[model samples]
Target: METRSRVLFVRAGLPEPALNVEIHDPDGGWLATSDLVWREGRVVGEYQGAHHFGDYGRGDDDIARRRLIEGSGWLFVDFTKGDYYARPRRLALLRRLAGHLDCALDPAGLAAIEDSLELPGPPVRPCGA
Candidate 1:
């Protein structure tokens, strides 16, 4: 999933983000290890799986971790399975991430990536049939 996310960002002309980076406080205390980190942009992204929100009781811990990271003056972004798979959600996520990174998005690149996904498209019909 991390690889897929990276591909999505790169294919959309967004800068490639660092993977599994450990964030720390100024005092050298460990905050969290984010799935995606843009140190220059001070942005941290997490791909939350089912365990994070399911009955496993990790949601509270995740929230606390996010707070710790945010308290240190970093923007935190999270993505769920739906956010990665659903077209609308994926586009929104990419836009949001780009905005956080203070970068412009390439609509053409994004469109090309979407086309390359090879998902089922509308049926074709003979002209004037």
Candidate 2:
């Protein structure tokens, strides 16, 4: 999942993010270890498989963890498997980043990336034909 997320960001020509990053404050307090993070953008994204959202502690943990992270002014981007490989969903993720940072990303650059991505596993059609 992390590999897929990394591929998505890199292919999109966004800033390559650090994976499994342990973030801390000036006082050395452990805030959280994010899945994929663009530290300078204060952006962190997580890919949660469906099981993680079930009747388990994982869901609660996610809620608390996101709250803690966001409280400190960091933004969290959450999505599932389908959102990763699909072009429209992936574009939405990038748009979120551009909006959050108040910048416009080059559409042509992202379109180029989307054209080149190859997903893992059997065929799943893109969100729209």
Candidate 3:
């Protein structure tokens, strides 16, 4: 969730999606606790940490959760550490996913965000410099 918050900040003013959100099944049972839910857009974002693929049961649960979420007309974007570590790749993936849902991020707005994050430039120099 800390990482998600940082990413959201880097992306600028997009609303923080609801975290650890619960969704119910037709029979009223708990379907899943989505990491981040974009309620109005029916989009969900999941941050897949190390534990996600570590065991069979965990993997199976993820599959089942995805199936249920998809069944409800929501799109999910699954992210791993590698994705978060690379800004350009992450942005590209986000753009593609947003495009798929016809809710693309505004390019100008994104550029402003990048500028605010100082992302396009090289990393900050040492104090001596």
Identify the leading candidate in terms of lDDT. 1
Q: Encode model 1's per-residue lDDT on 1-129: one tens digit a residue.
A: 766776678767688788899999999999888899999999998988877878545888898999999999999999987777787888889899999999987777777656444322332223354
Q: Is candidate 1 or candidate 2 better by lDDT?
A: 1
Residue pairs with backbone overlap in model 1: none
TM-scores for all predictions: 0.84, 0.76, 0.69
lDDT of 3 by residue, 72-119 (tens): 777877877655556675566567556644564756656754434333
Q: How many backbone clashes does candidate 1 have?
A: 0
The per-model lDDT (C-alpha) reads 0.81, 0.73, 0.65
Structure candidate 2, residue pairs in collision: none
**Prediction RMSDs, each to the true structure:** 9.1, 7.0, 6.9
Clashing pairs in 3: none
Candidates by lDDT, descending order: 1, 2, 3
> lDDT of candidate 1 vs native?
0.81
TM-score comparison, 1 vs 2, better candidate? 1
When summed lDDT is taken over every stretch of 10 residues in candidate 3, the lowest stretch is: 115-124
Task: Give the better candidate number (2 or 3) by TM-score.
Answer: 2
